[model samples]
Target: MDGVLVHEERAIPGAAEFIAALRRHERPFLVLTNNSIFTPRDLRARLHAAGLDIPQESIWTSALATAKFLSEQRPEGTAYVIGEAGLTTALHDVGYVMTTRDPEYVVLGETRTYSFEAITKAIQLIESGARFIATNPDPTGPSPSGSLPATGSVAALITKATGVEPYFVGKPNPLMMRTALNRIEAHSETTVMIGDRMDTDVLSGLEAGLRSILVLTGSTAPGQVERFPFRPTRVVDSIADVVPLVTELAEGDADGA
Candidate 1:
């Protein structure tokens, strides 16, 4: 409910009321995000700073899932990371060493400090047979300002430089979705994914067999829907619309029951 909850540090129309409605009804929901720049705690703080009240545990970021995947892979050698502090810290916390030379793996995510030197070293590592891993494949992230290029843009740069495609560990990938679903304890049929991007958020839901809703407030615009192969079950203009749709669905379920 970040961008939909508050746009550009200003609360969206009826967003606070919608959240209040959810709290009043005791509906279970999770704010799942493919952006790896922030940890769950960091995201919660940012949202709170924007005046949207949410607990730290109520938020999830792709960095958390990427850390989990890296931990399981047991990457012992140095890793070339092209991401922000959150991604670097997550990887280091999971026991993976970080470096720019003779690395065992190259991990890519979002960072404002992305440099040509880092890209050059990453390509060299990939050429030297270092495994390439990406936190998420999202090329863009939404903000109050506008759409910003994300880790996927850097990933593409690495791909062009080295001709090697990295394995993605975030949303639209089943592993991350399964992780979030497990945390929420919601089955695919009972869960709904709400987001602004169709490729990452909506597709992740589809991959996990959950119902998906696309909102126009973020990366996706109304006209672009026709160009994509994957279509959301329902399309709304904003999170305010989502509240009514969810209420309708709840009533229908009750009637059927």
Candidate 2:
């Protein structure tokens, strides 16, 4: 969502028009993000502020996917989480109990601040047999100044301390795309994954059996596409290039083609 629709909280060119076209055509799509720092409502507000009129239900985050996975794997389970309201609220909504004492899982997610005490506790918990889980595998996140240490970096520290590797539940992991597909009742055959990063987004989509489109608006440059052994179904300059495809798909659907 950050790169495809907006870059640094500013709407990318044609992003708003693309969303409008989708809505006008009655197309079902979700704005996906690996960031687990904010809830869907929070993301919706941010998108709206950037001039994109996306609903809360149309935004999906790694936090939501992690919570759903935990709830289904172990209903009413307990977790010791180190993250923001997004991760905590999702787990709570899924009837999860959060506690530091003997929790079933130690869930790690993205946050602006990383607490040393919390990291120590998480390591201890993992050492004590609590399973480890992380929202995303992004090692660093973007900031105005520079890149900041993200969940993956901390997860690596915890793993080194406890010899337990965390199971990540965000992009690059096909489970993330599959879970999103389940939420929208979308089929791999008909779904198209549009992303700015070939490593995570395109890889996930390709592994999930969906067509992938790579946009050069962020992360990936035109020259880098060929460096990857695999390629997206199509490579476009930006989201602007894909807007017409939305109209074409809508027309085809209308004609039962």
Candidate 3:
């Protein structure tokens, strides 16, 4: 979402129009994000602010996926959570108890303020026998100033201290794509994933058996894409270029009807 739809909170060219085209054609789609700092409602408002009218249900985050994963693992289990409102809220919704005392899991997510004190406590919890889990494998997040160390980097630090590697539940892990597919009841053969990065978005979608489209408005460049062993089903300038394809689908479906 940060790339394919909006980059740095600003709507990319023709992004809102593409969304409108999808809605008008009744296409089922989701705005996927590896960031676990914002809830669906929060994301919805963010997109809305950028002139895109995506619904809350249409936004899928690593936070929600992490919550779902934990819920499936142990219903109402306890975790020592490290993150912001999105991660905490999702865990609470899943009936998980957030604590530091002998938790069932040590859940980690992206946070702007990664305190040293919190990292120490997290390392202690992991060393004490709690399983480690993180939202995504991204080592850093983009910011106006530059790249900021993300959940993955912090997770690496914890792993070094406790000799425990965190199980990342977000992209480029196929688990994230599969869960989002399940949430939308979408079939791999029929669903299409549009993203801006080759390593995470395109790779995850391909591993999940969905057709992936790569856009050039973000981290991945055309030259770098060839370096990757895998490839997306299609490559476009941005979401703007996909509008014609979507319109074709709408027309085709109408004709079939």
What TM-score does candidate 2 get on C-alpha atoms?
0.98
Clashing pairs in 1: none
Tens-digit lDDT string for candidate 2 (24-130): 98889999999999999999999999999999999999999999999999999999999999999999999999999999999999999999999999999998999
lDDT of 2 at 85: 93
Q: Report the poorest 10 consecutive residues by lDDT, candidate 1.
A: 1-10
RMSD per model, one decimal = 2.4, 0.9, 1.2
Q: State every prediction's TM-score relative to the real structure.
A: 0.88, 0.98, 0.97
Lowest summed lDDT window (length 10), candidate 3: 248-257
Question: What tens-digit string does per-residue lDDT give for candidate 3 at 1-257?
Answer: 98888989999998988998988888888889999999999999988998988889898899999999999999999999999999999999999999888999999999999999999999998888999999999999999999999999999999999999999999989999999988888899988999999999999989999998999999899889999999999999999999999989778877993
Report the alpha-carbon TM-score of model 3 versus the true structure: 0.97
Sorted on TM-score, best first, the list reads: 2, 3, 1
Query: Which is the winner by TM-score between candidate 1 and candidate 2?
Result: 2
Query: Number of clashes in every candidate structure?
Result: 0, 0, 0
Displacement of residue 199 (Cα, Å) in model 3 is: 0.7
Which residue pairs in model 3 clash with each other? none
lDDT of 3: 0.93
